[model samples]
Target: MVTRPASPSSRARLASARGTPRPDRQMAILLAAEKLFAQHGYHGVSIRQIAEEAQVPLALVGYYYGPKSELFHAIFEHWQGTIQERLALLQQVLAGPPTEAFLRQVVEAFVRPVLVQRASTEGEYYAQLVGRELARQTPETHRVLTEFFDPLAHSFIDAIHAARPGHDRARAAWAYQFALGALLHHITDHRAPTLSRGRNQVCAPEAAALLVDFITAGIAAVMPLPSSLSPSPTASPSPRRRAPSPSTTSRRQA
Candidate 1:
């Protein structure tokens, strides 16, 4: 019996099957999973599909990363540095008591990383994944958000509050959400170019400056809730009126 050399195509399949070993293996799975999860909702995709898409053995997916949820999480962990970058920028902006300028910087810090990522080929899938998860509001998605983002939100929200002292906390909080909503919508919104009749790209470079400007003014514009309206739970309580003295009441009666 004679052993024969494998064909190039056979070797290629073997290479994909072995899956680049270590870091590359994990990355291939991560990228495949990210694209699939983004295109189809989390529930809509499966572990086997990811393995096939990545062209790695099914068990290796688990061996390298674990279950589907963990793979989903790995995607975020892969990009954790971006969150840290934003946090660092945010802290710098927040170092001085927040000014109008700080508000713009804060908005830039919050929007730029996500926007730039969304604009890039490498990050496009991850951006889409984010948009879908937010829409689904699934338990897994909430878990990820809580683990990775809640702290960031609190920091930025506090920064916004610090930036504008006269405004109630509720206003500051809503303004944060509103700014977030604008960025999320802008990144995920597909109709912008069509809506603009080819005048805009979804991730146009100019849009970053414009987005920061728009969100800054919007944050600045968050008015305190009306006095007649009940205060938000976080709002400082209104003082009660002092009771009239009994002597004064008697004098009035007399």
Candidate 2:
């Protein structure tokens, strides 16, 4: 048979073609890692297991992520992007006039984006992962949580303060924390039997109104001095003299 030799250019082209699968393989590893991490806490997972789940070469996980901690951090960084996009939408809503009427809008802005995603499979998994991480409270996980949450909480405090200027800084911070606790419960409590018992409900539009009112009232109650400072409530009680005439009339009748 007459044989043909491959040219250097052809060999280079083949080599380049062979390299194209690398990125796809890396992405597969990440997706597998995310799923595994979601299902099993970080400590429960291993790189070898992840590589097997991804069906990629065992070396690729270390090559892409360096270590399991790095892989977890990468996943967290991806989640941060999603959080930033949602916060940006919230910021736009907050830029408008801040009023009691806007309180529900504010709550919805903070909450709806997260709750809306619960319908999707990936979102459900991600939410579960976040809950698990919070429960775990590993140092690495705590760092990620604080890094992701603290700024958002501070911004929310600013928004609350802007909406109710009479509120003091401490009270505003407390209100923000309360609002967050409520939101966190809503997100993490997937099996709240209280809902079936009619004691609590999640994602109800009325619950939005209830939250706005509850938070507003709680803040207002805690910061009563704000209202006390207003002229309407602070007006001095009209002074009254003793009814001397009535005493004299009673003495004369006796």
Question: CA RMSD for every model?
Answer: 14.5, 17.8
Summarize candidate 1's per-residue lDDT along 28-50 as a digit string, tens digits.
88899999999998999999999
Q: Give Cα-based local distance difference scores for all models.
A: 0.71, 0.61
As for candidate 1, its clashing pairs are: none
TM-score for all predictions?
0.78, 0.67
Error of 1 at 17 (Å): 6.2
The most accurate candidate by TM-score is 1
lDDT at residue 61 of model 2 (Cα atoms): 71
lDDT of 2: 0.61
Model 2 alpha-carbon drift over 4 Å, by segment = 1-19, 135-137, 192-225, 228-254
Q: Write the per-residue lDDT of candidate 2 for residues 64-104, one digit (tens) a residue.
A: 67779878777767667666765776677665543344444
Cα lDDT for residue 209, model 1?
Answer: 89
Which prediction has the highest lDDT against the true structure? Answer: 1
Q: Backbone collision count in every prediction?
A: 0, 0
Candidate 1 — what's its lDDT? 0.71
